[model samples]
Target: MVLASGSPRRKELLNNIGLMFRVQTSEIDEHIDAHASPQDNVMKLALQKATAVANSCDDAIVIGADTVVVLEGQILGKPSDTKEAVEMLQSLQGRVHEVFTGIALVEVRAGNIYRTQERARCTRVWMKPLDRDRMEWYVGTGDPMDKAGAYGIQGIGSILVDQIEGCFFNVMGLSVSLIDEMFKNWGIQVGTKIRSQGV
Candidate 1:
């Protein structure tokens, strides 16, 4: 099996589930469409990553995923710089935002491709009201610079979040339950030690 992402968070998630897989990051345009719904955009990006990585192998099951933070119909990806990260965090404070994570599984056999599954999971997160000093101090940690909406719910940023509805793993960038559901659709029960092409 293969994972088409370079995120350590994603790697950790898979490791926690005891899945043996290789990392194969995909190179694709990740631009978000202003008019596309968060669900549609994430799904498209995930499929693109999966298909791109799958094309390089003769037989392998590849998993690709994309995550985004949506607020008031605007999509927020990973902040490009500290300034942008701070701005994102400032806007997200004291409000409810949606985090959407899309997952795609591609099965390749003898060079033939079988599009197994593509779906998106959403989680609603509520952030505690933060003053400028608090937001700036958090951003100084440099954690938000690499996260969507400029916050890492699994780390120090967790303090900024007041509550959440839906899958907590989704906020972490991958939803293990959703991935298990996809595997079930392919007749593979998770935790049964199912191996793929290699490791």
Candidate 2:
């Protein structure tokens, strides 16, 4: 299997599940069309990422996922710098944002005869109000610099969050429960490697 994302967090999540997959970053452009709905954009982005690599890897099952944070229909992307990171956190303070992760799995073979999946997982993330000192300290840690919504629930950024209303793993990156269902729906019996992990 191949993972077509550059995120270390996604790699860590897969590793934690004991899945054997190779890292191959996809070069698909991720520009969101202004007219596209959030669900369409996320799913298209993820499918593009996976199929882009499927062009090169003819013998592997490819997995690609894209995460986006949306509040009141406004999409918040990765931070440009610490100041932007702080700004994003401050904007999200005391508010609820919806996190969407679109996952795509493609089977590769002759002519890449395969299937494509685009499933969106959402989590309601409520952040505690950000204080000046606390926000500054969090920005200093540099964890928010590359994350969507300017926070990571699995790391130091967790301190900023009050709670999540849905899949906790979706906030981390990939939704394990959703992924397992997807795999099964695709008729892939995940073998012994994932049995211990409750897959």
Predictions in order: lDDT: 0.90, 0.83
Q: Model 1 misses residue 168 by how many Å?
A: 0.4
Stretches of candidate 1 above 4 Å error? 196-199
Judge candidate 2 at residue 111 and give its lDDT. 55
The Cα RMSD in angstroms, rounded to one decimal, for candidate 1 relative to the true structure is 1.4
Tens-digit per-residue lDDT, 1-199, candidate 2:
8889989988988887777788899887788777877777778888899898888876777888888888888888788888888888888999999999888888787656377777988999999988978988988988888888788998788888998899988887788778777888876666553344332
Could you give me the TM-score of model 1 versus the true structure? 0.95
Q: What lDDT tens digits, residue by residue, belong to model 1 across residues 22-115?
A: 9999999998888888999999999899999999978788999999999998899999988888899889989999999999999999887866
Estimate the TM-score for candidate 2: 0.92
Query: TM-score for all predictions?
Result: 0.95, 0.92
For candidate 2, the 10 contiguous residues with the lowest summed lDDT are 190-199
